[model samples]
Target: MGSQAPGKGAKGPRILNVNVGVLGHVDSGKTSMVAALSTKLSTAALDKHPQSKERGITLDLGFSSFSVPLPAHLQHLPYDELQFTLVDCPGHASLIRTIIGGVQIIDMMVLVVDITKGLQTQTAECLVVGEVATSNMVVALNKCDLVPAEERPKAIRKAQKRLAQTFNLTKFAGVPMVPITAKPGGGGTGTSAAPDAEGLEELQAHLVAMVPTQPRALAAAGPLLFSIDHCFPIKGQGTVLTGTVLQGAVAVGDTIELPGLKLSKQVKSMQVFKRPVTKASQGDRVGICVTQLDPSLIERGLACAPGTVPTFNGAVAAVEKIRFYAGQVPSKAKFHVSVGHTTVMASLTFFGLPDGQGVSQEAALVQMIENLGRMALTGVPMPFDKSRDYVYQGALVIGAKFDGDIHGESCRLAFYGRLVTLINPSKPAELQQLRVYKMKEKRGVIERINEDQGNAIVRGMFKKETDPAIYTGLRVVTGRGEDGVIESSFGKSGKLKVHFAKGIQQAGRSSSDNAVILRCKRYINEHDRKRLRQ
Candidate 1:
């Protein structure tokens, strides 16, 4: 029944939704670089807010998209047939946790290095992280334009050579390093916005060749990993879950198998961008509506779906110990771990090796004990189990000696036995028009910022009186700033309160008004201004 996903209800030529992440040292221009990769102009161009500009650091993740025009050979394919979502990850040491978080969910990735600066400490660290976590990678020798014409190619070469010699990133063994500037390309001054268009085109062709138009085959079927990266509610609509499809597909009424985060909600609706769609395919990013959950339950890095996907128990005998590299958080460690969107409290218990051979001793037996919780399980060799926790324990996974290796041979998710391969929606005309319009609209550019956290803006039309989606969407987006009583409560009072400035007041503004939403910029950030202008 399953050969390859046939083009059944496709809206365009076979569409492959590819999500690529940028990893590099701080200030290596990961964000600026992605802005250049987009098909349209983006405000990430001026993200140099006072705080970020002052420190030259990207605190949160930034997102943008662009379409890879099919090769002249594939042009006959719908123009928007192949779309790519690029996530710009932070490179700052302080945000190492967040940076690595980006790699956990992506498929293929691009590593950006400043040609002029070569690879820094984090670049090397990021390489090792990728080697251990992902298999496909490409390097972008950013700022070739910074070097003298005679020196640029050599600079790019040195960087490429470094990838092999330094980190031994064999997965990207023969991958070419393209040189260009992210500042202009990131759409700042529009410098090389196309970033050596020909080279980029060649790179895309190479990627397509490597990614193979088929989903990577796995052992079992049924459970799908839906990594939630972004979430928002449409005015009259309910909540939407957006993320790259790690594995599996979803049709109008299909049940999802996201075992790790313990979510088993039925999909209410599905869409690509804002356009309605009947199905979602693997390796694609989609916004799905789900039932039976508070918006708070959904956060970034959440793996979810309906029914039993897989699960591992607190007492998975094979486990030895879990630890991170030096300078990594928690000397002894204690915190929450997530599978899909499910958060579980876990305690770090070091075990296995006796502390001789190398980083991780070669032995398997209880070494130390760290207390963990029920809802959340500690990180093991593979993806977490469903609510019940039945993750298969394997030798390679348990055998591997790493202070902390997120995967093990035994840890794997089940593939859905029956499937509906979505023909890439064949909506070229629709894609291009939307790209042009969306590229111009600039929505996420404002108060609502990085959705991995709470929303800053409350978007809804005010009525003289009557029903509101808030009744449906709820005042869910309300809540407080990074601090205050708001975090403690939701919906009615406590944390959800917003104080409106006297000069600017909503008609229904309650009598008391000083707090004015702890959310959104007090003086209005550039993004807010843009939304206002729009």
Candidate 2:
């Protein structure tokens, strides 16, 4: 059954939405399986991107959904109906980042494998990425028709053995593996060219038996946090953003925040899997239209919520060492870090560990500095109260040696990280018109009015003196770490004596001619004046 009405009685299947990711190496039958399933039982399409048709490989994420029969045994459970939005992730080595993006939002995955090739390089990397996402996995031993019918049992055993050894320490231990023949043009017998309806039926039954529809705690309530994976403008519908909802729910007429873009927008419309819905909850693949915002302002890897999510350039987190990673945690080592849907370059600065040396298997707290992107924000940032039991609640994944042929046998090291204390850099002060003062002696410089100045007018919101709210004792900062504070605000010009705690330290000289000052201008703009105009 397709996605029916929300409620269900004992007679019919109850429609429960679940997102199942189809992930594997390139040419591993991920797209084929989706096409065949959609053709037979559902109404979703796969490989709609033009690049995918030209190259005959998935270059981006493709989505297709279908409904499978709920077994008689499962009918008595909480929700008898199960509808899966199959997320087909690209498997090419160059597109591994996109694969991580797909894996980031999946609840479970169907790992398709070519029975002949066993486990390729990208396949292993996909598994590692899925592990970091904490998604449940079930393997599809595809292309079974390529091997002789007599040798099918042997091929299945070999794939199972490799998986057991690879997942010795992970939660993927003893993951169920099934055999199938995903033929060309969505045809599969138990082989390459012909289609076998019975074989497909068995596979669907297995899926229904293995996966369950479960609701997550605290997902229904909280700020409506959604990540944007694709954005574009429609002819008359304004801008649309498409992605899976990571947490909470959103409805039409609700206002949301895009912190990175510094814009607030209202939800004009919402569609889930091409069916218009009044609201979308977590795990639903949705496309949302907002009120006339520029699509260019939003891109992949940005998040939307009820308000601006907390952003920081650096954080101090505890690194949980993966047993399979062969190398030690190097100091200042650059790695691509993925948090939520945002991935950026970050460096690790190790602190004291158990042996007071290189990284051991034991967990160690380290500082993570965001070296590349503008900022790193999390779905749920740490709350201000530190004494709570769960102070560190967010998750991070680090990928190293990703450049060049990442699918080589030697390059397999990507693992998850945990946060301890998130480090937020000093925020820049609001822009203001003030000049640096130069005293006769360099040691005691004070704030001074700009030269060639006239009697300033208090026109509009412009004021002659600084607001008293920003007086002395407030910490002042310029270009990171170069900090000072207002010691005295005692003049008509609101000139304050800035005392540099560490003294003015600049390049080249012990003291410099210009002292960078930080100030918060308290002028009301047009937008603010409207409220006060009444």
Candidate 3:
């Protein structure tokens, strides 16, 4: 496909595509910045949504492109042209899901910040998203023209210092920040004459310099996985699915599956930024035209080689709580989980190795990345191994030794993780294989002791309606460090007989503080099983 030249009517040279996400707070000129730099636009570009035009804020993702000659560093590659596809993501707090979905496809990011406003709430949120999505970033300090000529330099320096302080805690520390006025004189409405943008050329230069070093692993090697962001039927032709190619490659005649709908369609044609193309590969934003599928059935989803993507009910991941979130992340709580371009509600259960049994923090992070990479390559979950014992956590909290005070108004990014397993709830056999459990403990006073029989009647451990038979064989411990086993049910009122082989300690028998404690693990999958049955 790289060897193939452009179609007869196509204007540009053979192009190598690169996706750059344009993200920022609402009204930070993200869309205007793209418009100033882009030379071409896709069907869905530039606030095309009716609600967006009426409300004067972006509510969905927008697409546009601009082409440049291949840089000196990339001349060794195949194509002579480098096309930067601008993905303008909505910055509204409520539309964060859309921003997250857009970030997954980009190779780098251009974070736009209002120079006058410095870093707002949504701007900080975009930075957090960039930290998780991509490694390369360039900060665009926009609306520089608003400052007086005498104060411009000082204002820019002050904003830069504040941004430096903010990024000091993030991975994007030391990233380049360029002053730009995407739309000078505050002209956003279409009625006004278009104004020449300031610093756009310099911004583009920084983007081109970063392109050569950006990572594009498995760009054309893995199984075809195309993320469909827009689907619509043409008048005479078939339906067109416009999106970015996430993995592998696809040609005009290859068969593709809509895994979400359990349907397959052959690619009748392909295009990149409205230019006809014979093939498209990973990282290239292209439109695949197909037939015999209703456009309404798919708004945004994955289209891949048959049988590559699977449908599952639950998943397990190696999660780290986001430091900015102030609230606790409790287990079994439902969160809006975004995978690729789809966001769904998912119940989370957290487990880790015992205190002394766990690895170092650095080692855990490395292992987590590797686990995520494996799951990404193959759409299968890492099953919970039953042979190993794990400690269950009631809530995810930052250790006081590691946590630092943060602003009260920061975005709530609870936690992030790499998928470990994709659970199929309908299969009881599969559910039994998941070994994640919650540790339960109960304590009660020993009402009476039968020293001669080497047994004691435990009264407070079980309630009136509780059945002790289920825990008859389990072990128990006393506050004074005596070990005992549950022998059998004692009486009708939910009491049990506990036997101590070494006999109860003398101090424990007399001390009111001495109490019996029982600890056990309750598998989480059992609860899921009961929920499904109900």
Best by TM-score: 3
Winning model by lDDT: 3
Report residue 151 deviation for candidate 3 (angstroms): 0.9
Output the lDDT of residue 57, model 3.
Answer: 82
Off-target runs (Cα >4 Å) in candidate 2 are: 1-14, 39-45, 69-80, 158-163, 167-169, 184-198, 212-214, 352-396, 418-421, 425-534
lDDT of each: 0.46, 0.57, 0.73
How well is each residue in 252-324 modelled by candidate 1, as lDDT tens digits? 6776644545556677887665556666666666678876556665456444455434444342222222222
lDDT, model 3: 0.73
Task: Give the Å shift of residue 320 in candidate 1.
Answer: 11
Per-residue lDDT for 29 in model 1?
Answer: 69
In TM-score terms, candidate 2 sits at 0.65
Q: All candidates' TM-scores? A: 0.54, 0.65, 0.74
Q: Tens digit of lDDT per residue, candidate 3, span 379-480?
A: 223243211111111111111111222333556666665566555556666666765444567787788888887788887887867655567788899888
- The parts of candidate 3 lying over 4 Å away from their true place are 1-12, 189-195, 212-214, 353-410, 426-428, 437-534
Candidate 2 local lDDT, 41-116, one digit each (tens): 2222356566777777888777767775555665654555567777888889888777776776777788888878
